[model samples]
Target chain A: MTGSEVKKLFYMENKKGVLGKLKDGLLKTRRNLTERIEGVFGGRIDAQALEDMEEILITSDLGVKASKEIIGIIERTDPVNLRETLKGEIFNILKKGEASLLTNGHKPAVIMVVGVNGNGKTTTIGKLAKRFKDEGKEVLLVAGDTFRAAAIEQLSVWGERVGVKVVKHKSGADPGAVVFDAIQSEKAKGADVVIVDTAGRLHTKAPLMEELKKIKRVMDKELPGAPHEVLLVIDASTGQNAIEQARIFHEAIGVTGIVLTKLDGTAKGGIIIAIIRELEIPVKMIGIGEKIDDLRDFNAEEFTEALFE
Target chain B: MFEGLTNKLEGIFRKLRGRGILKEEDVLSALKEIRLALLEADVNFKVVKDFVERIKGRAIGQEILQSLTPGQQVIKVVHEELTSLMGESYKKTHLSPNPPTVLMLVGLQGSGKTTTAGKLANLFKKEGRQPLLVAADTQRPAAIEQLSLLSSQIGVNFYGTKDGDNPIRVCEDATHKAKREGFEPVIIDTAGRLHIDDALMDELKMVREKILPHEILLVADAMTGQDAVNIAQRFDEALNLTGIILTKMDGDARGGAAISMMAVTGKPIKLIGVGEKLDLLEPFHPNRMASRILGMGDVLSIIEKAEASIEKEEALRLEKKLGTDSFTLEDFRGQLKQMKKMGPLSQILDLIPGLGKFRSEINIDDRELIKVEAIIDSMTKKERGNYAIINGNRRKRIALGSGTMVTDVNRVLKQFIQVKKMMKAFSRRPMGGKGGLNIAREVMKWQ
Candidate 1:
């Protein structure tokens, strides 16, 4: 779909505001990339133009492997139509990862948020909680990050800010127990959605991965197909190692979607395009800033527009 | 993190091995691989271009040496370029001559400023100085609480105002408190902010103006991508940072941010966070990291840590065996016994391939080491020297003798093979200390 078509069809929440926010949000990345390829796609067939175009995309954090693939695909097309061909290739891949979270599934549908340390997991949860609460759903945030100091407190502050009740325990309590307890009581509490805030861990830590698996197992036992969404929150600034994070975490815990956090900054979460192209994990959301209102659903057209802007 | 880059470089060099001289085509293809590897490592595009250009200049037709393989010659040039680009000298946080040295930590959001504050305090506290951790991060929710909790964990003094709405006021209050409490070094943990955020940048400038920090450290994530250089430059322009503390170095990020930041800002990384624990902070060694990026393990860091637990002679012997590729299962067993004294085998074993992929938890620490040791002990002398001879039947027998599962024996054998190859990778020559460049350079003189 074209950028305007998607903007018109989708974005019922903030048709005007979303685009404005995204424009400003991606200003740095836009300036960096848009300026690099300003004269690239306009010329007749020139190998220099294509090489520079590939470099622009790679420099914007699209990754070497993905950039090479896209460049190769674009090379087959006539140079005069490079922009349309490139956009088409990106839109095709972006479309694969554009689904939103399963918001209307089972009542009190569970959303498990996970990532390596300091990738804005708690902040993303706060924003998600605000969104769900704004939608008039009874949101219950479970503090499953018992590892980091004040992690529970961080989630609690988000809950307080968003006007939702949080299920939590003291730091160092068993996270699986917390998840089990949250799941068991959600129906009685009349909660319409449960967002799990898990401890940030590198996927390379096998035991931590096992713990996450245990948490999933406990959830499934308590409610089959619980944790309907396992969202991996990747910092936009994260480099090539994000591939490993996506691979291992998906292998260990079966990640259903990815939330690209801190996209408001200059670090193009362009890696998500790479992740989706390689791993097929849907891009459910993009966290624009630290504020509760800074999050937006992953719109393929909007994301590609921002990247190619 | 660097395994991919090293493997590619090694493969490219291996293709050119046994050649007495570097052909023009060989160097061009090798330069292409090096360019891709650097880009994949997330080094800044501009920096990568300059780097590849330099390598091309140094590795072209006239640069070949008769005494070395084409691979060795290219590697020597590449290693020198990496080390020079990263700044060859090591550095630490600049402590003032006067007491109450102030260090202001600043960076982008979630760049680990608060955690690095704790680590810096902990490191200095271990040195017998009472370092105060100041939680001036008033923006993020519960950031102050996190720093306060870290201070308590580190058993060092902490200074934070619960209702200090302004971070400048908070730093002002914290510096006074540090002076009053005899906290020798005041670590002001400023809130992480986007470099483009003018208001927050101004706030940091105000905090610096008020506290007059002896050192302004930009705590950055080693996993940061191309924006790492831009982020560092902006912060350096705003705050004129004294150094950097790179966190999450333990993770499998190629840590290209380290190279990018140092190259752009010309700032030395003072410390690195290698693990989650506060005590996992260690001095930054540029040469070791440079060597590491080139696929040479951080042999000096490992040898130095080992020296603390084992006798100097034993440490030297272990180093010799590794350099000579004579490290056997028996030597592995002996090292395990001594490594037990150095703390968790997994942490020290990050330099070891395969076994380090997943540094097991504490519960799996010494127990796994003991099982592997027993499996090795159950092996015959010849089997110890040659791990390949341990067949399925032998693995079952070793498992029975060690009173463990056969899978345990299999894992030990796998680890032995990996460790064997890992040692061979480090065996080009003695890796630690100076004169490391001379072997290739020294050989070049014979040309």
Candidate 2:
């Protein structure tokens, strides 16, 4: 859907008093901008008007750097169609950051999922596994989050639903060891894909983070260039703080991409702009709902459109 | 004053102080503290990991400052960066140019949607706008009744269909009523599901189709931690929310929802429900909140308030006297009167950067200020300006006049001297060109 379509969706009128107030607020900002632009064009659109527009963007939580960049472009291009120009700029910002899920050249492509606990890392793994299996790839699920209770059971249940084999050890066992075994089994069984789930540890714990590094090292040793994707699962509801979490995880262990879970909840999903602007990391997938099928591949155009809509 | 977080921060800072600058080890240590704090505050673990990595990249290879303490500098940087990470501006709810602006509140059950509706109405009412409240949450038992009671208490008009009418119909009817009655703003409190159920989503979609709300605000409970983020994402996908209203912030909720929800849902946090009181609602200010979490008093904000509320000539005179060590009880009384113009002392304290955690503990009472004033009022003008004039007989007479014992007067005098001494010391210290002494200077000037 186009951003204009999403914008139109928000403009629909209802009797709900709370929704009406909120709609008025959003529309008022947009209307104020339109009026200001009209006024600027009627007279002389000077640097001060441009500055005012920049302030408006920044105040809207577009961040200072991004707002400056947008203003710079507007000043340079002097586009006649402000709305289209703004939409194009927003679309480009989102487009530059896209996370690709597919990988080639490695049979039974190994993907290691790492994140802090309760970030839906295991569930994301299950959903991804199901996605691959439904695409006709023989997938193997490894319950590497062995530190937490019921984690193995949780993955086992997902494996059963997805019709995939799960390799797991007792709780408190080495997560790295489980990944090592899962990869070996995948090769022997000729599985099309191998997804490893690692224990959720705070990035603050040096020892735990060191363990994740070791796990990646061991996986690479067993299968050259194995664990091709180190997807960092971040909760979408974290607003701008999620950017901080993403940066920390990327520094500790190179995060190939991001899985932004819980996109269904917050209005601050606009924070995706801030995250992409700062980290330059691709958002591979988004979890819009709890169902397995709800994990949709990140589409910048679609997401941007959803925001305006 | 944030006993729990302060101890954790102290541990982390102690380890980092020895390292000089923020190194990988320091980052690790600090992350550990932050991780524990976020978890204790009920933040999702995955979110914490990503958060730590971001801090690490910015912290490493940094030069250690020798003049200022390393711990203090690191804390300052961390706090500043965290605030920036959460978006630097305070986002206000969008208002349409056209009258009868629609705002829809969505969330799961027990997310405090009803209370938030009342709070939003109260906020608009304070701005002199007439807001109509609509009870669209027909699923939950007594949801409509609760909204009715809150609306009555807040003095806002409420519309709801009795006998179990459809929520969509209720919203449509309410909007028509609001337009007819010339209400400027309309707030709708919708039904919340226990989870992201299809039935709930479909019902919300129907309401959206019927009303076409300008903004869909998800009312989320901060205490739910990571689950709050998940629920927000669901509602955003189903309803396409315009913003978020975080509730139950008055509790020890670590505020993970504020961070996670913004990151996940890409929505701005429009308002926060700090207390159950209708007037306790505050617009979400990222910088102020960041400083509060870091334990630094928000002196800048307080100064801003003082600038707005305190008379310019009075403030300048007080500033001059404070700088010259000529401040006295007379100045103190003037400051107290000025503070009254700003609003409640408790509310002012809560705005201070690092003082949010200690807001409950801070003794800010009008009665206490009144007592202090009475004591000052009983003293002769000469005694008020130069506290040294009050001898034993004079002190006894002043105390009796103020309805207090001599000992209480003596205690006040002793505390005033200590405060004056502290100000003297603070003025001598370099403020690092950042107006660090603003709060102290302002307080002393008031005295």
Best by lDDT: 1
lDDT of 2 at B242: 88
What is the C-alpha lDDT profile of model 2 across B47-99, one tens digit per residue?
55677777666555363334346666677767776676567788888678887
Backbone clashes under 3 angstroms, per model: 0, 79
Report chain A TM-scores, every model. 0.91, 0.77
Query: Interface root-mean-square deviation for each candidate?
Result: 9.1, 15.1
For candidate 2, write residues A140-249 as lDDT tens digits. Answer: 88888876445687688678757888898987798888888877763425887889988765453455677888999888998888778889887554433455467777
CA deviation > 4 Å runs, candidate 1: A1-16, A186-189, B65-68, B309-347, B352-367, B370-447
Worst 10 residues of 2 chain A by lDDT: A1-10
Look at candidate 1 and give me any clashing residue pairs: none
Candidate 2's C-alpha runs over 4 A off are A1-309, B1-11, B14-23, B57-81, B138-155, B161-163, B307-347, B350-367, B370-406, B409-447
Per-residue CA lDDT of candidate 1, range B1-447, in tens? 465676667667667775776678878888898888889989888899999999888788566644356678788889899988887878867678877899888998888888888888888987899998888886677888999999999899887776336778778887778778788899888878889889779888887888788899999998999889889999999989999888988777878888899999998898888778777788888877667666666767765665555655665576677745567888777666666655554455455433222223212334566677788999899988877778889988899999999988887777666655656666676655322222212212222
**Cα lDDT computed for each candidate against the true fold:** 0.79, 0.68
lDDT of 1 at B26: 78
- The 10-residue segment of model 2 chain B with minimum total lDDT is B431-440
